[model samples]
Target chain A: MTYTFHWEVPLQNLPLFLWGALATLEISGIAVLLGLLIATCGALARLSKHRLLRGAATVYVEVIRNTPFLVQLFYVYFGLVVVGINLEAFSVAILTLTINCGAYCTEIIRAGIQSIHRGQTEAGLSLGMTQWQVFRYVILMPTLRVVWPPLASQFIATMLGSSVVSQISAEELTYAGMFLESRTFRTFEIFFAIAILYFVMARLFSFLFSLTGQKVFREAWGQL
Target chain B: MRRHGRSWGWIAVLGIVLALAWTASASAAESTLDQVLKRGKLLVGIGLGAPPFGMYDADKKPTGYDVDLAKLIAEELKVEIEWVDTTSVNRIPYLLTNKVDLVIATFGNTPERAKQVAFTKPYSSWNLVLLGWKKDRNIKSYKDLKGKTVAVTRGTTQDIAITKLAPEAKIVRYEDDPVAMLAFEQKKADVMPTAEVLALKKVKENKDMEIKGLVSRSWAAIGVRRGDPDWLQWLNTFMDWHGGQGKFAELFEKWNGVQMPVALPRW
Candidate 1:
């Protein structure tokens, strides 16, 4: 069928969409950072000698990784609201995103920690380092460097998944496109624009993560 | 394996030819109305998430004004109804594709949509409003909506209205009415543009929100496939009878808990 295509609608709403893109970045950035913190604890727990600690951490990771992220988000946003714990949409988005990302991040970082040789721990202990110091300086830091690339990609996936939160009406980039499409009936133009914007944002985030990685772990990058 | 594959391919070809012949004969045998009558069922599409108009009850059965209306139509036609739960976005598509003989969704009649499907006479009218928390006295009108966050269902009548009224407002659109309501309830949005009836129900339950003001009014009508003059006339006649007998108003009040409109605009 023949039809006219208009790019003007999305063009005029460019500023609004850019603002939403920034929100998406902010949500993903904060969620990833917070997720890494949770993952560190989870990874350490799974490695702990105590059976309770390891079992609890393993259960947390398995349950989250097994279920769909959308269901988890809905449970957190809708299920909790029923009990009178009403969290704002943005906070709910970030909170669920972090917990969902944490499960996978735990697996990645735990693998990195397990891959470490026993000799490194022995050398640190021989040098009179305390257990906490050995883990913080010798094990955790190096394991993070080893898992950095995969973890960064995981964070990127989390950012893409953030689009699903628009179901809850969080004012993210995808929400902007849907809002514009509803107003103008220019579905093709708006979706095309949003697809391009998301592609650019994903690349931009990947580049930023690489730059930050280089700055934080110069020696690690050299060895890689 | 090769001999088995050859035999299976021939069977597939024969199956396709038989299916084509069956459809060709079926189309040649009767018109759409006659087909529906002969089949002893009318396929109707009804909106699922729009409460008071079309929504599922706690028992998981569809119960709403539209559902009741469709039931009446089916009774008059002396046929059973097979309902296809539809969304605002897909209701028209469902009718156009012949997936449903009629759409009793809260579908608005507009010239833009008329080109795609035929609209029977309007059965109901609902006014849209910008509603917010009762304590938020600052937002009295559309002017106060500037730079505020408003939630609306995507591609709905209210969504388009708010864009025209307050272009500067940050409009957050959801997939359906329920999600939009959830967003407003969670205080994620400063205001919401929704139907007056829907907003009133929420206000009465929450005791914290009020209808700020009117936004726009839309007439809801039944939709049918294009080029079906006979079927269209029958549906229009059914609505005329129902409306004339006051059954429409009775159903309206039964679902909305308010009096029906005195007059629905003739399309």
Candidate 2:
């Protein structure tokens, strides 16, 4: 069997792929930021004294964490359309990724918060710090330092999972690759290029997180 | 942490094992037509999101020529129609694996494909035409498409035809007709390979586009399992009876807004 490798098909669409990569980054980046915000609120709610607040947070985390991301994406995109709530594919993708990532990040951040010694809270309170002030000035920064690596890893996972958005025909990296592959019938070449691109993107996310961690957590880590 | 990772590893292994077992069980079923008849439903596979052939109308109901034809066949068989939405690529797999009794998708009949599945007589045919901006005088012939980018739906006859006709041209495949049309309209592609009817619709809808060149005429037929001679004969007979009553032409005009050919070719 003779095999001819045509790398030209995918390469010709490099501009389109790059645009798709940019979109992937934009979605994941926005989702990560939004997830972080939602996670903080969720973690806080889970720690609340009100039973209803804690229960609601627990349900959100458990439901999202247990269900597949693909299912969640379909429900948001297709199910919403059924109810006359039509959302653009890109918006739906960002919304779903943010919600899904928020659940995982909530648990991770909550764990970090719980890991801190009780004396730290006492230390801040005795210094005339309000509850919110203690969280912002003392507890929050340290908790982030403890959870940054795992949270960053989850962000990377979210970046990779963004590929699932193509199911709803979102113009992301995988969608671009699929479009090229279908036209050229060069499935291997297209997929190989996509695989390498995804790998580089994942590594890029990791590298950025590492640099941020060093800058933000240098004191909290306490040493080299 | 080590134990958690190890447990995940075990779960992955178990998942793969279960998936293989499930696939094996899924494929080794009995005769598809028998299954369909026994179930009292003609499990017909139809393509979704392909306009003028199979697509959802404004009412959000599946409508088009392929769907109408499938409904007729199911009515003749004295069974309820269960429309299983399929893609251009998965139609054959859906039939061979007993997922559907008949694939009435826009399935082009080709010799390479004949090895895998049985096809009935042609229900419809359309020329694969190149479409480009009307003002683009540079793209009048096949030679002009040497290095141009062309948009086509993935795994469709137009995609295959374009690949063979212009190996040098960059072809971008979309998931469906509407997406490919969007790519064309967005000027992401220099041209698009689509059915003649679809190309004409594009020209009528957008004053900028017109047919550039003809690739090849492709005939679409109902696909069935390879070993089912009885099923194939029944489908052919159904097509002939339906065609004689002029229902095919009625559907042709209803969807295409033009008269079909005097007779669709018989093989």
Tell me the whole-model lDDT of each prediction, alpha carbons only.
0.82, 0.81
Candidate closest to the true structure, highest DockQ: 1
Error of 2 at A209 (Å): 8.1
* lDDT of prediction 2: 0.81
lDDT string, candidate 1, B1-267, tens digits: 798689758866865675455345323323557778989999989998998889888999998999999999989989999989887765754664467888998988877677667899988888888889888899997778988989888777787788789999988777787877877887768999888888887788888888888888888899887676778888889988888888877888899989864466432
lDDT per residue (tens digit) for residues A105-196 in model 2: 99999999999888989998998989988887677888898899999999999999999888666779998887665445455567767876
Q: What share of the true interface contacts does each candidate keep?
A: 0.31, 0.11
Best by TM-score: 1
Off-target runs (Cα >4 Å) in candidate 2 are A1-143, A165-220, B1-16, B56-60, B89-93, B112-116, B240-254, B259-263
In model 1, what are the clashing residue pairs, if there are any? none
Candidate 1 fnat reads: 0.31
Looking at chain B only, the TM-scores across the models are 0.84, 0.87
Where's the lowest-lDDT run of ten residues in candidate 1 chain A? A1-10
Candidate 1 TM-score, true structure as reference: 0.74
> Which CAPRI level is candidate 1?
incorrect
